[model samples]
Target: MNPGVADAALEGGSAPVGPRRGRLGRPSWPLTILMIAASLTVLVPLYFTIVMAFKSPAQIGSGSGLEFPSPIVWDNFARAWEMVGFGRSLMVTALITVFSVAGAIVVCSMVAYAIARNWHRRAYKVAYIYLLSGLFVPFTVLILPLIKLTAMLGIDGPVGVTLIHIVGGIAFNSLLYIAFLRSIPLELEESARIDGATTWQVFWRVIFPLLGPMNATVGIFAFLGAWNDFLLPQMMIANPELQTLPVVQQLFQGEFNTEYNLAFASYLMAMVPTLIAFVFAQKWVMSGVMRGAIK
Candidate 1:
């Protein structure tokens, strides 16, 4: 054999190089530019809000909305904090969100595990369909009845609102968990069972820990929903002291007029906690979203 031919054969035959193409068979630059523009569009409003949050009332009224404040004023935050009862509202919102997310994760994960494990059973299929049906029933349709029921039960405040969040969140979160759970191998649970672990022990020891990503995804979603929710908290709890952050922030708005600066300040304050949380848990959230998408 010719030495050149042998070398070419050894190298598996030279293939012509081509420009890289993205999944859509297009050059990547256009997509990159499009994505950058889309991100800027979304961030622009948030940037405006942050700028307004630090501006004095005078500067907000006279200066361009997009321009940075001269001699940045921290008093807007202080005033907004006091006016909105940020300390109290933060605590109320946190409590409700924490309980609601925890309850939803626990209840939905357990139900999802059971359903995934027992999917071969007709009864389990029926049960899964029944639970999933909750997803179609819009919460607005049930709000009036929920209010009446909660009032009668004497639990119409934060507790009632927390329960509502948990119940409302379960269907969707359960679906995510179920999808992910179905992808988990049953051999792990079976091995635990063979070692004399009861069903509950196998779930707690072997199954639940593997669900961390989905749990983070669901928890972030639940927290954001419950924290930003206004209608339910507004309707269920009329007590001024018990209002959540979104509900309390509305106090800055009036029928005929509004305090734009303070309202923006309050809005920024309300957003910071959730933003920080998402920043921290973004990796897990992305993983869970990808896993859910694949399954």
Candidate 2:
């Protein structure tokens, strides 16, 4: 081979090399600009709400919303606590959240397992359809009947409200669990049966371990739902001492219309635990959502 000719051919004749900037393939500046713009739209309002939560009533009324507080009113949190009865509301809210999440996880998982494991069975097919039908039936239509039934059962106050939250969870929670269970391979389950394991053993020892991430996702969703519920608690529990966070937060706002800072300070406190849980559960939630979307 001729060395000069071979080298020229290998470099594709090296004709008129252009500027290096265009060849570098820089990322689209337009898309980055849009994303930053969209994020600011949401974050700016949230940032103002947070600053207002920490401000004194006079400062909140007079100061510019975008600017930092002249004097940070840290005492708003303490005043907000007593104003909202944070101690009692916190206990009731915690109780409702825990019980509702626990019930939803156990009940929904079992229902999902049964449906997914026996999907070919005619009975299960019918039942699954029946449950899916409830998905479109809005909860507003059912609340009237629910209130009457609760009244008949002498079920009132925080515990009664908690049960209602769990019952209302059946539609969406079961759907998520069922979709996740469907994604799991049946071969693992069938092999367990062949090893002389009972149905409960197959579920508890085999399929249950794989459900951890999905369960975390479901529990976080259920807890957030229960924690933020308002009207259900109001109708079921008229007693001030038994009220949950959102319900009492409303009452706080209505009673103290002039004190926006104090009311918001208390509301933000109620939101803290839920926000923390979501931060931790975000990874599991992404996993669960992906599992459901798989073909």
Model 1 C-alpha lDDT per residue in residues 35-106, reported as the tens digit of each score? 999999879999999998887777878877899987698888888898878999999999998899899899
lDDT of each: 0.83, 0.78
Compared with the true structure, what per-residue lDDT tens digits does model 2 show for residues 1-295? 6756654542332322223334666768999899999999878976876787888777878867776765788888998899888998899989989999998888889888998878899999998888878779887898888888877788877778888887787877788888668768989988999999999998889988888867876776677678888889888785778898888888564653788878778877887777776678655555444433331
Model 2 TM: 0.80
TM-score of every prediction relative to native: 0.82, 0.80
* Maximum-lDDT candidate: 1
* Clash pairs (backbone) in predicted model 1: none
lDDT of 2 at 224: 69
Among residues 3 or more apart in sequence or in different chains, the pairs in candidate 2 whose N, CA or C atoms overlap within 3 Å are none
Give the number of the best model, judged by TM-score. Answer: 1
Residue 1 in candidate 2, Cα distance off native in Å: 59
* Residue 143 displacement (Å), model 2: 0.7
